[model samples]
Target: MKVKPWLSHLKPYPPGKTLEEILKESGSLTTIYKLNSNENPLGPSPKVIEALRKSLSEIHLYPEASYLTLRKALSEKWEVFPEEVILGNGSNEVIEFLFKAYLFEGDEIIVSEPSFLMYTKFAEIYGVNIKRVSLTGELCHDLEGILKALSPKTKMIFLDHPHNPTGQCLKRKDWEAFFQRLPKEVLVVMDEAYGEFIEDEEVPLGIEFIKKGYPVMVVRTFSKFYGLAGLRLGYGLGRKEIIQELEKVRQPFNVNLLAVKAGLSVLSDLEYQKKTRELVLTGRKFLTKALSELGFKVYPSEANFIMGDFGKRVDQIYEALLSAGIFVRPLKAYGFPTSLRITIGIEEANAKLIEVIKRTISG
Candidate 1:
């Protein structure tokens, strides 16, 4: 059997190591801190758990094909109409919908060089040309560079705001300038996987642009701030017409029953949401200051993780942390070989990580 010509060249996405994988590798280390995947260290909301428990009985049935209840909830939250909302198994599937509905083979999409790997991966899978613009010196997306790279064939641009790996975000002015210069025909897919973690008031949410009537789709997920990674729930907000086209390509019953229940429950859990935000903001500051004090160059992050350049000691430090039952993501694939992307863990886990790093460096 013959595979597509590009199939042989495609590389699999390198996900963060699992706790099970780490424990197996570091036998006898019972206490494992998984600070790699940028998960909510505080865990899911109690309300979400209760909702899931109540939903267990419905596992045998298919979820509502339209997911209207969840969509209505999201529409209200984002101040968009239900018709403008599209849910995915994860926001990733929403991305695939764009390819299925709009992109054709040989068309082009622009992405930052070190942005989410899925954008390029999907491009490769669909045989679409990808134009990768490198990030600026400050590790933020070069909006100017992206604009310069656009061509007539460019159909879409995928930007992971509060950018993945680095967690750097653009200011409202930067976003405004980019949008002003962007072609009206091209769609902008704002992947806000980490949007809920952004504490800075200056940082603009993608939904703000959608309200202004830009051809933008803001993709968000429950996996981050809601602590529902296991549920794999995410949604996209855009103009109703754009969403309608994408909706045509979405799979029926794509989001499961429990995830829907959990999403609805969590949406109303104001207290849980507030606590999650406070934890991430405080932890982000603590880790940034702690890492910098140890002579590491920590990038300012709006997301739940920080990317610290540990100089040449990164490898040794990474290994030592692993042996000590700590797991943080190494960013070699994201092009920063000497840096580690550490998720802001709980207070105890953060302290342990700081102490472990200090000891590793001193010894």
Candidate 2:
């Protein structure tokens, strides 16, 4: 049997190890602190749990193919027409929708060197050409370099705001400058997976650009801030025509029944949202300060995770933490071998991580 020749070169995504995997590997540690995936430390909202319980009886029925209820809720929340919204199993599926709708073999797309692995992964799967621009001196996307890399065949640009791993974000003015210079033919896919964690007022949300009628698609997910990673729900907002085209590529009922219920329930849970935000903000500050004081270079982050450079001790520090039943992300794949991306866990988890790091480094 023959497969697409590209499959020979494709590499699978390297995900963080699960607690069960860690336990099996170590065999001695019974407790685990997983600070790797940048997940919400507060877990799911109680309202979401209640909604899921009620929804269990509906498992026998298929979810509505259009997912109108959840779409309308998101539309009202974001003040967009329901027709402009596109739901996905995860925002990643929405991304695949873009590729399915627009990209063809030999077409080009631009992305930052270390932005999101999925962008490159998808490009490889689709046989689309990828132009990877290196980040700027400050570890932010190099907009000028990206613009220079664009060609007539370039169809899209995938940029992750509050960029993954490092959590650096571009300012409104910086985005404005890039948009002004961007060719109208090229579409910009703003991956705002961490949008809810952004604390800086100067950082512009992608919806602001969509409102101004920019050829932009803002892909977001419930996985991060909404604590719905297990549910696999996300959506995209764009022009009605673009969304309609993308929707045509979507499979019927891609989102599951319980995920739809959980998404709707969380949308109305204001108290849960507030608590999650506060916890992330407080934890981010504490981790940043604590890590910096330990003689490490802590990058400024507006997202729920902080990336710190431990210099020569990165491998030793990571191994020590794992042995102590703590797991943080090592950034070698993102080109930062000496850095680690630590999710802002709850107060206790953050403190425990700090204590372990202090001991590991001192010894």
Candidate 3:
């Protein structure tokens, strides 16, 4: 009876089901392939595992309150000052920090319709009105539409580069044009959660805009390419003043000790980083080509996942694949009823998934 009016209608974000849940659902423990979430199929780097093992004994002590060491490591990696970086439990937390620091009820934010669902999720939580523009014909961010949606109430614009669900990125020139039209009052949050896997030369990385003095913040995650999803460590880069403000809203010891240690060890592991990028690129192309050859329309992707429209057989195919212990993300929630977003997994998983799809389609 005491719940706020806003609380009455809220629904939680639907995270993908756990591997254990899928195993239980299918009644099979072996031969399961998980490509539903865009996770690194190669698993965490050996260095991270060793680092986490070393930190286990010191679990009694709390993590460094300021997280300075992790910040310094990120600074060295991104060529930015430590003061310009703010760490998060995950990049998702950084997004939350932005809302806490800047949002008030009745304020508005702009977002692409099919980008990261978290943008709208958080907006609704904060009672911020969201103006969502649909993607253009090529499935890229419609910069013109975004510009048209802007207004005085617009407090921020959240963009997921190499957008989630679609995996298409806006190029530098397109971004520049959009920036030129945007008013200086609108702060931009560029979520580059999967930036490292991008192989496109024309796509502009978020850090470049931050360097240009735009009121923009670039968020990066160790989750995808670093294979540290379970560790929950990510960071944001912005103008020193903006980062300092975000830092003030951050809780002390937000990042756990083991994740901090793992972040430091893996951030500089050049060999593992190289192998991760290579695996995703090679695996993405292989899966895309294979899926296309199987008579599906595979959208071009620059990230670690590809989106394919499976036509009328989507729901049937999804259930059949689930029974076969292969899990891929269905996009019905993102408003694409006939599409599934498949992560670029290991070579064997990719090959086996294709085989399963062929068998399912044939039946």
Candidate 4:
């Protein structure tokens, strides 16, 4: 049997430890405060839960292939036309759609080094030539470095604003500058998975750039702020022409019935949206201050997670916390040997995490 040469060296995305798996490993703890995956600490929204229950009866029916209702809800919410929307199983699928529609083998794409592994993973799967530019010293996307690295063959740029792992955000002026110099043919893919949690007023959202007529595609998910990670509902917003091309490559019925219903319902649940946002924003501040007070270097974050450099004690503290039923993301895989990415939890959970770190470090 012949295998694609590009796939031979590829590794599957490493799975995060599930509660069951973690319990088995610990052999003791019953409660797990899961913060490793950046999921909403609140779990599914109450409105979403009710919507899903109502949607259960429709599971036997196939979802609408175009997902027009949800698309319209998103378009109204974002102020874009319905034709500018394309739904995906997850935001990750939208990334794949971009590859399927535009990128071909040997075409070039630029990504910040260690931004999101999935970008490079998809590049490798499709045999595209990936150019990874180094992030700035402040751990933000190096817009300058990216511009210098561009070539005629470049097709897209994938940047996770409120960058993953580090949780740093670049200013609005910087983004505006990038678009001014970027080539018209190259589309900028803003993977704003955590966009809802941004607290900084100076940072710009991808949607704003779209209104300004810049070449950009914004990928968003229900997973992060909406407490809908399990639903796998995500969408991309772009110009109608770009959306049409992406639609051509998208799988039929890519989003499920329940996700569509919940998505539509959640959009109308303005109170629930407000509650979730407040929870993330407040928790983000408390965690950052507490982590910093503990003598760790906490990076400024517009996202819900806090990235802290625990110095040489990182590995030791990570294992200790895991044993104590507290799970946080170790960043060694992302090349931060002395840091961890911690999702902001509810008040008690956040307090517990900080307390554990304080105790582990002091003794």
Candidate 4's residue-wise lDDT over 289-309, tens digit each?
988888889999888888999
Q: Any runs in candidate 4 off by more than 4 Å, and if so which? A: none
lDDT (10s digit) by residue, model 2, range 104-212? 9999999999888999899999999999999998899999999899889999999999899889999999999999999998999999999999999999999999999
Give the per-residue lDDT of model 1 (tens digit) for 251-281.
Answer: 8889989999999999999999998898889
Compared with the true structure, model 3 gives a TM-score of 0.97
Query: lDDT, candidate 1, residue 148?
Result: 94
| True lDDT of residue 61, candidate 4 | 99
Which of 2 and 3 is the better model by lDDT?
Answer: 2
Question: Clashes in each model (backbone N, CA, C under 3 Å)?
Answer: 0, 0, 0, 0
Clashing pairs in 4: none
Q: Report the lDDT tens digits of candidate 3 across residue range 1-363.
A: 597677678888888888878778877447887889898888899998888888899999999888888899889878999999999999999999999888999999999988898888888888899998999987888889989998999999999997998888878998998889899989999999999988889998999988888778999998999989888989999999888888889999999998899999998788999998999999989989988998999988888999999999899888877877789999998999999999888888888888888998887
Cand. 3 Cα-lDDT? 0.89
Task: Indicate the TM-score of model 1.
Answer: 0.98
Query: What lDDT would candidate 4 get against the real structure?
Result: 0.89
